[model samples]
Target: MPPSADPTVSVTLAEIARIAGVGRAAVSNWRRRHDSFPAPVGGTDTSPQFALSQVEEWLRRQGKLDEVGSRERLWPEFEALGDRDAMGRAIAVAGARLARLTDKEAGPDDSAGWLPGGTDLSDAQRSLVERAVGLAKKHGARDTFDFLLGRWLDTHVRQINVTPSPLAALMAEVAELSRGGEAGDVGTVLDPACGTGGLLLAAARQWAGTADVPASGAPLRLLGQDVDATQAALAAVRLLLAGRSPERESAWGVDVRAGNTLRADPHPDVRADVVLCNPPFNERDWGYEELATDARWTYGLPPRTEPELAWTQHALSRLAPGGTAVLLLPPGVASRRAGRRVRAGLLRSGVLRAVVALPPGSAPPHSVALHLWVLRAPAEGGTDAGAGVLLVDAADVQQEPSGGTQRAGRAAIDWPLLHRRVVSAVQELRTIQTTQTGQAPQTAQTTPAAPAGNADGDRPADHAVVPVIDLLDEEVDLTPARHVPKKATSANLGLRRSWNRFGTLLHELRDLTATLSALELSGEEPAGQGTVTVGDLLRAGALTMRAGQQPADGVVRTGDAPDDAVRVLTVADVLAGGRSSGWLTAPDASAGENAGGLTLTAPGEVVVVGAHRAFGAWVETDAPTVLGSQLYALRADPALLDPWFLAGCLRAPANARQAGTHASTSSRIDVRRLQVLRLPLDEQRRYGEAFRRLTAFERSLREAGTIGGKLVDGLTDGIAAGRLPGNRP
Candidate 1:
């Protein structure tokens, strides 16, 4: 039986968008044309709401009642709604209903359902939701539903609005993995702000159901808390859907409710094994005078202008003496005027571990470059990790386009390479801890019996057991590279084991180069000159290209996009990193969007950076790699130059250096440069081989040294720690 109609279920433009799978603008149009919508139930200063029952019926009529989370219809509706205010009451009512539904207060269970509630369906509205969820079950689309719904609600509630910091994400994952060696199982991790709970989710997936994770729950623990209720509820649903709960048991202990770690504290005394977060960048809203005497400010008075400092202090206070934390912060936190004293204090205290300068792409489509701030408690009550700051320049990952007047785009993170590099660096640092302290422990052939004295002197036994300290250090500079070395510790050419891999790569590349040389020496080059300048080849359409840089460590270059995609690029990389200036007209903070040659790139399209128009730039790709699209993106081309081949061309010293001189404009380059300088087909192919060879050689050398250091680090450091798992004398 249908339940009583909801007269108060006010349907506003926003609510209509929420229910119709379209934007609010679409809802407004529907309201204008359809007379069935109930009269306005209530009104905000700028918007109005209608009966919930009427809204429900309208959704059913539109066939969108069962697909609330689908993004297919939402964008158009958003465009239609324009800037009109969404009636806030509609949201309040829906959220209240959702909360009640989630809590099982709407009614008793009426139908056998995945959701615990036996809530009865009232008006086709409830029926549609059930139907949509039911269809997801049929198609195995629950995860998508949950991800999108959570994102939508969070967007409205304003709890988790920030995007993920890719580099920061990589750092957190690496730190967690490294600790798995120390704790056996990384137990109980937490992220306070949680926003969309990316960190918490990443930590959970680390040892559960992921590529390397085992089936059963990991011995590791997970927890998250947020200040936004909608965000918290959304996170709760996400955690539940991810199989964190077993047979109705909770999946993780994450609460995305109200929580400002700096102001109102939750879980006050509990310490976590790992804490990963990217607190608000620079904040002035943080209360400065409220808690003048708070103990968390062990470093110095946190300036309200730099709220990131306060968050840093808060995260530090929460870590157990031996636990570790990785945070994403703006460059200002590392070397700003107002926060310098506090930053220095934390550094000198040996609480900071490393600082990594992330490339500009670190901020999703935004060009404001940031860094990773890694911190860990001292191992033996002392500040020195006994090492110099390991600095890393990642800006090169994001380089200028191949060529054109368009702006240079930021770089994308190569996660796999990044993960390996960071982990090996940390491990080498661990080895340092042992060497600075002394020698390794020795064990006898037979198992050593307990000492004559009581263990830990409980009741005065013969000898007491000594507790072991972990080998880890902290840095004064908040940058991840500061404590870590410029070269990968694993890349240590000085090591023997690493040399084996290095030698193999060297031999392989040398062999390949030799083969190419032989082919060249034979002169079997194409017969008819296969004449195909880029223009003729453009018609063939079978290639994709891109541009990149290996920027020096420490420099942070960012440019404004029409929208955050804009970037500062050299006329080298094919696709520019900037956004569509026509679309994102709002001027950015530093006035960069207009100040620079911001351009654009759509995902998966090929972009070519050439010396001249005839050959200056051309390429293609399908992935949404960033760029200021104005340069050049070849959509259907594979026979001419592959992606790897294209990347190599831009890396060539002669090609890159010479392209600038051939550039048409003072700041931007024209396509004519490459068209005349280099011909098509064979020569281009040769360039590709040469480029990949050098890159492969460079990689081989770097990887070999890194691998060797990683192998012997534990062995050599173990000799000093006495606790290094195996041999005892």
Candidate 2:
């Protein structure tokens, strides 16, 4: 079967640059300088789109077309169609061809109705399909299609709601842990809103990685449905390709269809052993009026504003007895006023087993931490109403610092640690359930009515096992934060580490002071070297400078921001000599830049305080950071200029005197006018190393002062309290 013809194709400047193996700036220059360049056929002035054929012809004339691979050339053509569904159809056609190549018994009519109108593909689309087949033959269909899908997802990420691969994998793992089974025992897995089949694929991979398949040879069934035809088609094709791969140890029966799971009920009577979902949030029109009387709302009628609850209930309705569902939902669904009735019902019925608050940026719309609600379809005539719900607050979990520019409070999720803690808590609850029910536990269930105690006799701050009756109050608030205690500070451990660091800093300070003392100064004045203004370096392309963005007052935030948020290097933070004091979401940081967003400060880039009397420059060695107000970030070409040397030069009083327009110290200095000493790269590096040492010496002094003060205060307080030996006052 062939996809319908798509005659026209258009491409953005970035795509043209990719096609020509050049930067986007080069493409822009070509458009501006060459009158013969193709005119914009579509799109706005800022992001103009050119006809693919015209661009291709031009590139051919320029001798750049030879650089593009056959498959690479097809992407722009696919984008030109400007229809996601049409591209999906073409991809499906390619998948079908690849499937037939691997499995000779697969009939030619396998993808007969996948394309629209049973029409033959246009020459351009046919070329794309053929190219895909060729690539698939070499790298394997699964890998080839995945590469293409990755590109597609990257392009339309903002438009499509995607479950990130990591999060999807975690969900699958958790579901498997709850279910306690080998692949053979799991009969079916269902995802109602299976966008691009991420969850389904994860489920398949998780199951395959577990124990060996049964000798019975019955394939694990993967069922999915989505509202978007194009996404559904893409998912179907992807699953089919994965299923046909020869390296797969276990068999998979994949059936993905295009239809609104909520509106049409595609798999109405089909109950699944496991259900995994990251359902759409805050949907106002999720069949509220017509489906008001729907039987799936077993808990209660979901408020119109509470679409996530509707999806949760639907998942429950489709679960086989003792089946488990793991759903990622917005945090609000746990405590919102409108969803309380349904939440209460779920808890009372013992269906809602656990609620885990994941760290922010764990899923889409990355500004807020999302919640995962672990659910179980009560076993036939077995409801653990007395059993407790587990509340795991893993929101504060972060990646252990790898000792570079990684800062404290950065929202990096420690996925492996989170997995272990969450799994342990759930396992303990399951054991409790088994003991109470007097039956062998086949799936994870709620804990016994009594709250479990730890070996140390202290409840862990990260998780809590609370009885359902305790959660049946008026609000029925199931927010994990509400139940789990705040993480306790390791004061003793922290104090010990701080004392160690203080000792190290003191040792370094002594060593550095001695090194500085040993420095011999020239007796006579030496001839001064020629100097160049920062503007001159810019013209010579030795360095590029960018000013810190003055984000709106409320935009620069502190405390519990998402993991994707950027650390904002502000003047105050620079002056105070500490880590970033504020954070900005990536989109907000990059909001108005024509080049797509704010450029982060790379390692060795120099960031200078642009205003204030204590003007200074520091070399950035931390992970990438976004610049905030009253700061200047300079990125020097290592071949032409040393970043540390440049930073040191900018910090000189002579440069400040020349660059500063006003006598007042608070006035901003003209960074472009700041002077740099001209020298060869090798000489610059020598000076750079000296400057680095000087900077470290100063930092050690500050650390020693701060630590010494804290240490002295602790000693004084201890003596005053008679906890330490001291002379009597």
Candidate 3:
């Protein structure tokens, strides 16, 4: 029957470009230039598809295939299955095969027969199964599936969603910490909507890593449920592999059931010690009407529109006394009108322990930063719940120098640093919680409170301890940014140090002012100077404009060489005006070669943001960084244009207005259409120099303002604390 249709195992030109780690144009060039390149086996003229195997063979012949990972190699076959259900089943089957092999119950020859559904595997399915088995043998089943599942999700991120790995790790850490200093002990952990089981896997790994936890003892009990049967099956396989030991066939306690957790509780009687979940956001049809009277809505009946709140209550309901549940939720759920009463109830009962605001790009529906709701089931008579909620603004906790280009909105996070900060903050909050409850403080030294109440207690930077009574108002907004304490008391020595630095900055600012005054400038441009559109410059060869390509969600592979790491410059980096902000290592050469249409900036290239608030910057660094998507790079012909002058003109208000008019949407602008003054080369250089000096002056002003602000705050706190003289001159 037409060779069983070959499962339509083909990739489009764009996918080919990604596989090759080259621009689409480069792939097109290859098709035209190479006589032996694979022919299109399917698809339309506009988007031709080539057999994946044939293309890979061709790439391998060209020595361009080394960078492709095994996970990536299998992705095309999975996609060829055509339906997500089918794909999920195939993955589950592969996971089952791996599990069998790990248990020594199946040989390599029995892989196809080990498929979970008992269906005879097709040729394409068998090939995928073999590849998966190989990967499992090499990387272990849990890691192999993790890689495969990550690639699958990356390929269909818009269609399917899972918690980002770093966030899942953070949640797992918080959940463990909430066990109240019970070192090396992990009680039962549950994830209501486990998806591909990232959180559950994290919990299992955490338990395994604990030095004090005995590996020979009963394995950690892990319970999970998912609406998708395929996901639940995959989760079970992962747990089985993760918890498996040489002495045992499987982990002692692992129950991952298919079906909705909210609709049908698989482990209704089991109250978990920790509940960690990254629930789906903005789910509309969450059985609200049917479950309106369900007993789990102990806080309040979650509004029909607020399914996230339902998830919150579900998690809280599953918590044992003094058990903690950490849920990753949308920021809007904290302040949305529909969920206000539910939020208020949560606060009043003291179940909500802390709300930590993570930076954007932590997870999908990635339009805004997500919040972590750290909660505890109230003890009998509410004795365990603390008086105040810990609010931590961790949005700034991920600052790290990185290299490589990323998509406009997706900034790379320093997971290790962020995790440390988060863990430390949580520990600090625990200490504060203990102190507020009249228990002796464990971490920090404390003095008797001043009788006059002139000084505030010691507070961690970016964290606030707001009493529950204060949060029970009409608008119980738990946003960390809204409630962060404004001032912090400092020691006399620290205040003096800050004042000295402030004075130095003030002196520098004065010097900068004098330098700026010495520069001669005309109020208006020369009368005869004419303006030209950026389009004109392109046609005249004054500059070349290129838009950056949107990068795939994770790991860009280049070749077989393990050290092939590349840095990407992001829009955030461009805004920050120095150094690369993120980088990704190519898992293989094909992806590494594509670089997602990223162009390296030569000195004198100008980069401009293509969305939201439009701005531009001149490339000054000699180091190479790939241009991120959502930015347009303009490499000026040095003989005809000056980089700084072009950048300054592009960033001007008039050009921004011109760009706005040409915008397809209110937020997206075509930087190519911006207007520029057609000044002579020499004149442009002069303007460029002037712009450079102005930027320096602006930098000085910002420094002065920062130092001045810190000076005032330090002096004020010092005076109030009786550490500095209050007498004024």
lDDT of 2: 0.73
lDDT of 2 by residue, 116-173 (tens): 2232566666677776776666566666677777767755656678887778888887
How should the candidates be ordered by lDDT, best one leading? Answer: 2, 3, 1
Predicted model with the maximum lDDT: 2
- Per-residue lDDT of model 1, residues 1-729, tens digit only: 223223544544654565555655566567678787656767642356566566666666767576333432222222222221121111222232332233243332232222212223333334334433433433333343453454354334322345453454575665664343543456667777776567777766654444233345454555666655434444544544454322333344444444666778765876877788767655577778897789889989887687888888888777776677888778767766677678667656767655666666556435555777677765546554334333344533433222211232323444444544455445544544545444432111111232465331111101111111211222223443333332222223224434555467667767766755565444474455432234444544544333333222222233323334333333433222223222221222112211122233454344555434323332323233323333455443445455445554433344435445543553333322332223365666666566556655554555545555666774565455454446567
> Who wins the TM-score comparison?
2
Q: Which stretch of 10 consecutive residues in model 1 shows the poorest summed lDDT?
A: 459-468
**Model 3: per-residue Cα lDDT over 433-505, one tens digit each:** 6557564323232222333633222223366667777777888888888877433332443466556666766
Q: Global lDDT for candidate 3?
A: 0.69
Judging by lDDT, tell me the better candidate of 2 and 3.
2
State each model's CA lDDT, in order. Answer: 0.48, 0.73, 0.69
Give me the displacement of residue 85 in model 2, in angstroms: 3.5
Q: Which stretches of candidate 1 lie over 4 Å from their true place?
A: 1-141, 150-169, 177-184, 207-220, 244-251, 379-389, 398-411, 438-729
Better of 2 and 3 by TM-score: 2
